[model samples]
Target: MKKVCWPYFDPEFDSLSERIYGPTCRVCIDNESLEDCTVVKVDSLNKQGLLLEVVQVLTDMNLIISKGYISSDAGWFMDVFHVKDADGNKLADQRVINYIQQAIGTTRDPPKPKAYTTGKPLEPEPHSERTTIEMTGTDRPGLFSEISAALADLHCNVVEAHAWSHNARLACVAYISDQSTDTPIEDHHRLAAIEDRLTTVLRATTSSATAGGNCTNQQQREAKSGGGGGTMTNVERRLHQLMLSVRDFDRPLAMMEVASEEGGKASVLIESCREKGYSIVTVQCRDRPRLMFDTVCTLTDMQYVIFHASVDSHDGYAFQEYFIRHVDGCALNTEGEKERVVKCLEAAIERRVCEGVRLELSAKQRVGLLSDITRVLRENGLAVVRADVATHGGKAVNAFYVRDISGNDVDMEFVESMRREMGPIDLAVRNEKSLMPPNTADHQRPRFSISDILKSKIERFSHNFVAIK
Candidate 1:
């Protein structure tokens, strides 16, 4: 038999994780029968955003974390969370417990060499200009919160926002639109009002060149960053933005001033490189809870493996870039395939937001019931990717991920067919109802900074769009 090296097979592997973060970690989950909840426990070396990672895992599983307790001593962290699944039932499945542990507790894979870029590309703002408001002044705690409140008072909704602080200095940039119009504020008086209120809250007491002044209409474009330069710091700020506005995932009042919000919108770009055998997709949209998870799941169900990703959320907008190849290692070599990918993504995102939940069903545990349900979906050109089916007290409660056979969204007509075929089956589906507060924190690699994102964008443009004359 051929032997394979497991991660913990050698002593050196443990040392590597200890050197970088802290120590190899262990995670576990079990059902609390009395309370009817799941208890997720984590023991890991301390790292930045560690708790956030745990929460993200629970969120991804369609589970609600009702409460948590965590403690860190020296470099080790011990945490516990009580959670419930989407159906408000206690987690009884042992497989689900293992899945949670693997998601939040597993060691990160070692980094790999990237497709190195040799020079800086002319990084341009990919979207049309909107009102960009900047503020710089004395650094103070809660500066971001105060500024956000001020903007809210003026009925301005941020599309994207970034804040950086250093050695007692703070800088912030926000692209916003008045909630009334979803367009950039055109009234000079209203713009001045917003500027004045933000300045007061930021507490730039002494008016001077370095003391910080407000700039309008220019995003931090070329503006020197005061203190933040670390890649993780920038991502932390994006996560902060996500945490702040996850439940408030509303688009600006209207479309981008320069283009339509169609599949081929200005901020949504899809390109493929045959030479590299991968596809690159860049998307700019409103940030919301579970939005990124849903997006990744859609791609996975479509049989794509993401090789690289860069995600940023600011003001009120989110920018996501994914480098991927088909699960079978095929590039999106044809224009029709590329277009289908973009259109499908757009539709999936919209459906997730509009419908609020995917498919959930409950049926009698009988011979071939699950098979017959799957056959119904298959006959209607739908495929099921992820599913949780278990019989509790003689009833089968199941959750399923359904998509189109051609990697597009399941059609509404087909959905109705599913509903009819699933008749007599108590499909206790959950529809998205109320908005919950957004919880944000993330870490993934190979992480990219703003510059890296730009260069990649330019490369895709040169490779996929440009032509030799």
Candidate 2:
């Protein structure tokens, strides 16, 4: 009859023990319940040949196996397996013991870490090493694309990125890697240059001449509304209309409308924009109402236009007559516009899903509260988008739109841990319509990677053997 074995180090015992020892004994001595253990070992001719060798041994022994894990630490390679022996015993065997000894003897020495040199450029790895670049400043459009283009020019690949805009400012983090290693020092120098270029780009993009031009018209309207106290309601109505128009557009666009006489109205517009996936820009109209258009321009590749109009009582029957004109033509939509919009929306939704936390702070029940939840979500690698905060009877209620979570990636244990950390919170995980699994109708044989199969088998044996103990 065939059997399975595992070799694991026990620091406390100062020796290697049969993870599965005797045919009718506990594999893990600490666990008394397990019994009927058996150990087996296999030999590999080459260090890299361990995977194939283990497969052959298992086949020869007629053992059934599943999952496994391999770890290398402290000058030793450890392979843990889960399997069942032949004779339908579902127990460990001696073959596992021999395999463990062979694996250890044949294990290769760990590779030495390479040092970065100044004169001689290092050879680039097949896969680029990931690094992050962070930018913070007054928010402006086109910032994202300008930085992306600069990285691209430097032969740097952007693997992942994130940007957030709030209170008239923006911050972003981009994961990038350099593809060329002809000169490592030169590549580092290029990164520095890119940083400098980024600063310049931000300055140019956020300048008053470029972004300021779009809000001139709104500023004038606000000034006029303030001058005519009776027209406050009319001005608010018009601003709301503009916001609705922008939101209703096929593409996402941020909107900011300011009127000095009706500051509350401006706040309402800003809140509405946030719900619609648009970054709210602050409008400060001291003399003439001015809207500061500051969003990641490159990501959206859009331009801003300011339209100013003066309405006279005689020109309009009962309301003021206003003139409308574009300050500048911003790029509207480009190639791949639909796909980009969908991706942005999907990302936004995922951020909301991952960032959501249950909150119970008051007598009344609340769904989502983001104040402390946002930080927690960020720590757990979640991005938040739309956050709704409401209060009923002195209790806070909150809901959020998030990015980067799906059922496939959800870990139940992690979710439970999060629940324990956050006091009395409810979680609503959203299903993404765009992410559907492929159909596997055909009964094609599942091709397993040699290493993967070996690992699986070892895990099966280890788990069963431990259970017996």
Candidate 3:
């Protein structure tokens, strides 16, 4: 029988007594009873980062909940969300409901009886020449992720490829095959969908300069007519646009898989650990879509505060070093906890779906890229708080502080998932903490680093180092 198993930490996780292998409580999204809001009820055995996972799922689904109630006791949790879809309408999609169920560690599909079989491996499917996925777009951080994600959504499995960038332009060509059939993609509609998704992402990559103008006339008409959903005045809209340029987003992370030529594996080493203190986490993994984001997200979900991060990617692997402490300012001393973290990170980086705030890109300084990024955020039920855009040797390095349109922090467990969790309620704070220093007991200012000094000098010397558009 083919068997699947969740990553296990120790005897407890592997034991039936722990209920990790027991019948899981069914997860459900109850919408029929509510008129204005959907009720998402999740009942499951509690696990680390379980709460944040729920939030991430809800946020990714573009659901807005006016209120929520949570109760947990004796290794079990029951969370309810009074929610509505991104369009401010009732949530009724069975597919979405099923997704939520599966995401929260519950399943509605009837369990298939185990199949008896010989232990011999099945014969492999025939191989073929690969369909190629090629991309030429703005070069920036997380750029590869956008391309890889588009391919993944089309169910195209990467076989091999070459990717590079020069002067803010990126070119990537991937040899790929259908994941299910292990053959070259022959479906024209699927090919078109892949191309269309890639194009949209590329547009987003270089879109800061071209966004918003086309919608301005329509927005003005709507504002004057008092019929559209927005309530911002024209002046407010202009100011909002201006603010977009000055905001510096956090550095986005991406991971991509390598072809056969490059052997790939993910590994983690936790050192300098003490009870109630800090640890140094080192992760080495194959680059996959959102690898950086997933790593950071997992750390945050586990309530770790990153005090320092050093990152580098070469060939086909990524190496990341992190100085971290728990949110309560404690160190992880248990092997089980550390193992859980390592496994969680592995799962996060390998995830292929574009659920929640997953896609990020770096691009050339297109005339309206910022405007476009902002517009896309609004359209996709995402909110951008802080951003940083700079040009380096004619190429732009930009970062964004973004969250799926969930407002307010759901306690400290989700600070990383929420990006600007500690900032003011509205996205109006001048000093952003999307990437703040490790949380300090007294909240003292972080000691200066070389880049900090250089950043200050650059701002002092360049009149437009961070000037608003």
Candidate 4:
């Protein structure tokens, strides 16, 4: 059986054991505590991947974590998060609060299995309105264009999609449906043909620089369920896992070393906390949404337990410090292991950073729309680096991050021409920038590294925890 990549972490706490022996998960939502953001405090019995669960729930709800303190050092977990809605205001909605309480609160029920029947012929997986197609392989110019054209040829309409490329690899999850029926594609033979065509496109060209060697059938089949039910899967998390599976982190040590101090790259420093038998990992990077989740998820998936951690952001830079040990309870004792952790964490953060100009298109939903748009982009010598496509109330809203085939800046004149050609479809360029360091020269204040205040923060919040060097 193929391993499940989504919901990468599974909690071991059963409802009966949780109540009796007591994980006693208590989630306290305090909107009164902070003026700028709501303070959410979670206390529970510590277990593997618990931090990720809390963060995942919050992120999935579209809550932004501005600051946080986490401690699970003494076999109990405590997390204090200062979070806000997308508009940068405290969570004020009663319905949202109630949902959070029910989700992570003490009386929360265990998650039910997410299985459903579509009652359709030749359904490989339970689905709803649309089928989801997930693909990953060596990234090359016009690759998405080819896939889009292929789907259009197969009479499939793309309703939503998201794609990410990193380290010469691409992973995409696209929600699609039948062009004629406007429903989930249920014909198994048809799905196999689509799958076969896409696989051929993926393997048509391979560059030696592509990570993970050659793209294989096993990699493609991991999440190829022919149903929109895959929408329930966390698209971003699945992309991270897919990239990780392809060994995106496995780069030449010399090349990896060069990235350690590069601009726009995450800087990771791993040290030992021998007294506590923990590895101290500190990451400093440009602040962005879900930064903490990416880091925590990577560590958890790598079999590391974060005993204590602090996440803070100021001046558009994020600072994270984690005291961690292996699942087997040993600190990173070798240089190679530490370097691997650094490279993996860096890859995780970089996975979601879109490259190039972002163009948002809003129009009435129609079959072959994506194919037409991608075809136009390819004709204009633009290559999609990343994209997000969705539909609401019969309106198709899509965002594509694209660059010139030669890796130059995208031309606005071509974009305008394409907009006119598409007719009535609202196409606008959205200024989407990657997480980049703030220009220090523009500000008079002296810049300080996370290390300058790391000691003070650790000393203040982690008195009960062991000291680190």
Kindly indicate the candidate among 3 and 4 with the higher TM-score: 4
Tens digit of lDDT per residue, candidate 4, span 1-469? 8876765444654566676765588889998867999999998887798898888767766677899999997678899999888777888777677666666764456542231112111212233677878888777789898889888998988877888877667788888888888878888988888888887787776545343444455574233645544422256777787788777676545456655544566789998877778899999988888888899989988999999999998878899999998999889999999989998998998877764356677888888888888888988888788888877778888888776776454444565566666767765553454454555332333322222333444443243221222
List CA RMSD, all candidates. Answer: 27.0, 31.7, 21.8, 12.7
Lowest summed lDDT across 10 adjacent residues in model 4 is found at 115-124
Give the 10-residue window scoring lowest on summed lDDT in candidate 1: 112-121
- Candidate 3, residue 463: Cα displacement in angstroms equals 39
lDDT scores in order? 0.50, 0.32, 0.46, 0.74
Would you list the clashing residue pairs of candidate 4?
A: none
Show model 1 residue runs off by greater than 4 Å: 1-23, 110-215, 220-469
Q: Which clashing pairs does model 1 show?
A: 158-316, 159-316, 159-317, 160-314, 160-315, 160-316, 161-314, 161-315, 182-253
- State the displacement of the C-alpha of residue 82, model 3, in Å, after optimal TM-score superposition: 2.4
Better of 1 and 2 by TM-score: 1
Sort by TM-score, best first: what order?
Answer: 4, 3, 1, 2
Top lDDT: which candidate number?
4
State the lDDT of candidate 1 residue by residue for 69-183, as single tens digits.
5554456767776666666677765656666666666767622111111111122221133466656554333444455556666776554444543223444555565576656
Which residue ranges in model 2 land beyond 4 Å of their true spot? 1-128, 181-188, 209-469
lDDT of 3 at 352: 26
TM-score of the candidate numbered 3?
Answer: 0.29
Question: TM-scores of all models?
Answer: 0.28, 0.22, 0.29, 0.80
